[model samples]
Target: MNTWCVAAPLCLSVQSYADGNLTLENKGEDGKGKCPFDPFQRYASVMFENKLYSATSMNFLGSEPVLMRSSPVSIRTEFKSSWLNEPNFVSMAHMSESVMSASGDDDKVYLFFSETAVECDCYNKLLVSRVARVCKGDVGGQRTLQKKWTSFLKARIDCPVLESQLPYIIQDTYRWCDPQQPWKDCLFFAVFTPQSDTSDLSAVCVYLVSDISKVFAEGKYKTPVPVETSFVKWVMYSGDVPFPRPGACIDNSARKAGITQTLDLPDRTLQFIKDKPLMDHAIQPIGEAPLLVRRGAKFTRIIVNQVQAADGEKYHVMFIGTEEGTMLKAVNYNGEMFIIEEVQLFQPPHPIKILKFSNVTRQLYAGSDYGAAQIPLATCGRSSSCMDCVLARDPYCGWDTVGGKCIVISNSQRELIQSVKEGDASLCPGADPVKPVNQSIWLGGNVKLSCPSASNLGKTTWEQDSSPLTLSTHLQLLQDGLLIFNASHSDTGVYRCLSVERSKAGEYTTTLAEYHVSIPEGGDDRNVISPEAQINGPSLAGLQVVVGLLLVSLLALLAWNFYKGHLPLPWNYRKKNREQSQETPDQEGLNSCTTYQDAQRPALAEDKPLVSGIDNGSRNNNHTRGAAAFSAAEENDDSTFTPPSLQYIDDESEM
Candidate 1:
């Protein structure tokens, strides 16, 4: 309904990322032989009659394109027919009832292909598009058309641009049916590009199953007649056709006798196909123009599904595959077409050659040059956040506020839809914060930091300390949002992943994942960090180093103070002048100040004499004293020696 809306992702990221829902595994193998056109152009593959069949080239540009069949138990069957000369097939289908006669001997498999005419070689090489049918029970004709289709008949498919009347060549075709509707109403949608490559115009023509059958019933046959002096002239031949149609699958009516065979058929019924190959009437698209008219990329394959919404209304959802490995989903709503979304399905740019859909699983399988891959038709759960769920205009998914997740809608989706339409975000309390992930690595080593986003619809950039990094070999930002390459301590910083998202509202930027990287100084633990460390956050080796250094400095400070003995007490004295004044000086005298014992600080006390009550002789270098023997105040003997100022001693004694 709206231009491709920008929605939030399950987890906010530069490229919207989540648990990848699309599971891809290589299926079959790389195609060996190319189609009749080119090895690069893959052939048409289809599931017919409960068996897998593909019409592929013998080799790259080799002779007749062979129709190959493979089953679970049987070896591959390569049905070679000389009739299919340089035939480039467009599509295949299993004929519904009524497409065949009552003979009950013809095949239900039908093919639409374009080939050069053998009979009209004299006139010119006419590129004819025809519908061919094969037999189901006929292994090989015993006498006639052995190993070839006996009931093979084809008619022309008329497709032209209505406005310019430019003849468009069929490039791709798809057969679509709705189980809930009548099978007879099914139609074949063929994509066409003008024969002139210079023209940028493309078209889609819808051909009815019944209209194609009319060409076999009563249509003119192109017959060439030789003139006496001129080239052969082409004319429409009119004649009574044979009973069992050449291309019709046999039922159980007049053909029940089982006598009618390709050899038994006369020229009248065979000529029916020749005259009717060119149907002048044109088949048009559902709307005014083609279902889609894109400019650059061509639509390679398409498949349609009837999706029933909650209201019991069914809509035909079309999935169109392009040459750019993109799958575009569209819906025919209210007589208008709306493109729902476009997704990049293939890992490489390979044009989609075949498209198949499963109604049971709602999954689409695309075949290309590389291989076949399956993708879910709906990506509802990819809208995890409430804002994303509301913005993602998907019919099959919605936000489950109670469950705190985006879920595929089945029963409890009505409320989600109503809330989103009403812009009610009350259910979502708040968005979860993107916690900064921590990591530790050694210098000269390498580490990878991934910035996985929920959706891949944004531009990602790596910023260190909020500044863009000029990434080099030493620090690299990979295409997939991985920060890797050689690492060093300088690389450690607050690395953030910023994703830029644009919407009709405007451009919005957000942080995806913040990496707090730390590198250990020493090269001792040379290996990478542990897995547990990754989950619990980066190692605290850097923080531990800082704490260790602080503890060592504290211990050294305590030991240095004990050496000077200044730390025991900020103020200390071995001689107390007050106590010395009370007691007479015994035969021994007191010792001098021991403040300058530490070589770290100059001996300022040496400039002044000792201030003790008993000023005994010059201070002996051998003077020794313990704390238990001295008790005196410097104030008690100020006259004995000019004592250092008490104020100065107080400041100097302060350790």
Candidate 2:
């Protein structure tokens, strides 16, 4: 069995931009210190010119009530107001939201607040709130210090009734004006009817003033000019009139008793009595403080459920912040309203107090309990295909099936393509629109490109310009066709399959299919070490044999020299010196044999052992012995030999 081990190059992909957690501090307010009022209590509204205005209402122990206003971005206070009359201000309820309208001679901002009478008996009774108008002309100098405020021509409607009993009482108000027609200004508010003591029956109400001439008329303040009001109901829950219901009613029985002239039913005034029981669905509550956009006479509702504030320039786009920590977006095309998208703009559980849109950059800003946030309008929208539509830059012209000509998809689709041509002439050229794959594939692999089937048989051709090669095949008419390539370098380019059909009448038709093929650059196989570079196991064993042979040869040479007695020069000289020293004593003792013979003293007492007479045979034996001894001495002398005693001495020294 063969196994292959592969090692691929490592590559680390880098992010296009840095990614980390971002903590942005609150713009103006330091979180460490205590603010005079709850920062969340302030609400923001945007004007047509893109300036942001915030409103705050606080009730102090002082006699006068205080109203505060400032620019959205500035920390410095801009405008302040005290109560008109000095009465111990009981509970002061500032409108949670404000609206800006320009229906009158001057641009006016309508502020809504609820007030209660300071006296004991009236203390428990909640005063109905009214819209207070502040004209643009009245504001002058830096920060517009000189201020004038006027109550709405209508009496203050009971807030509880406006909140619950009356369907038309605005629960929330949004500021809006039409740029094209400034005079046709309008305010949108959410209306709700009180069903139970706790729940609100919701709807949307719009107040519109078509003409401003009456409001601009020259007059002094005798009685406040009553601006004509009209109400439009949207999203009603049941059968309910959009009007305020008051808790008290004065008795007009004296007129009926003939004590005074008969009076009309309070002429242009609506009153409600608490004694009267409410019938089922008696109140029609509209949207609370609804943000509105006026397109001609049609009023577009910009907010949905729980929207605290909304600001929009064109009816086509709107930015709405809800009390549920959510920022919702809706777009109006023609007369239809569609919620495009929504983003969780605030942290969970923090209610969004205000939402303002910038006219300069068209960005939307939201204020919540924590801080403020801004989101680009382009980041939001309805269509998931919008990104692709923008990249195509095709103007998103709707397809014309009948006329075969592409036309813009206006409000009406059919009307746009009426005069365009039809059939195959209108089909998009080139390959089918490319779509992202489920997963990226490795290089040098076959990929299938799908195209719609043709009614007739046609020729399919695949070409890669980088490879300078083309593969063509005749395909039977099929819904989906597949082209194959035995992996080749030339097949790496963008592969396209064109199906061409030639009719018998000489008409040629073609449809295109495209696929992208990539072949990574590098050697296909890995380089491996050659066997020649590795040591052989058998060669190591052979080296051991050669070493053994060399050792044996050296040992034999040493043994041969010892056996021959041809020891080194140092061993030879030591043996010779020992022999000479031993021989000196031996030579002195043995010299008497030669001297006795010369002196003829053989017959002396100690030496006279033998008789004179001897047989010839015995004498011959003696002479033989003497001759042998003499011959051994002469051989030794001629050979330069050491004496026997010297030889014994050398042997002992050697041992």
- The C-alpha lDDT values of all candidates are 0.57, 0.35
How far off is residue 82 in model 1, in Å?
A: 12
Candidate 2 has its poorest 10 consecutive residues by lDDT at 273-282
How much RMSD separates candidate 1 from the native structure? 24.5
> Compared with the true structure, what per-residue lDDT tens digits does model 1 show for residues 306-340?
65653456666778888788888776545445566
Each prediction's RMSD over C-alphas, in Å, is: 24.5, 32.3
- Top candidate on lDDT is 1
Candidate 1 structure, TM-score to reference: 0.49
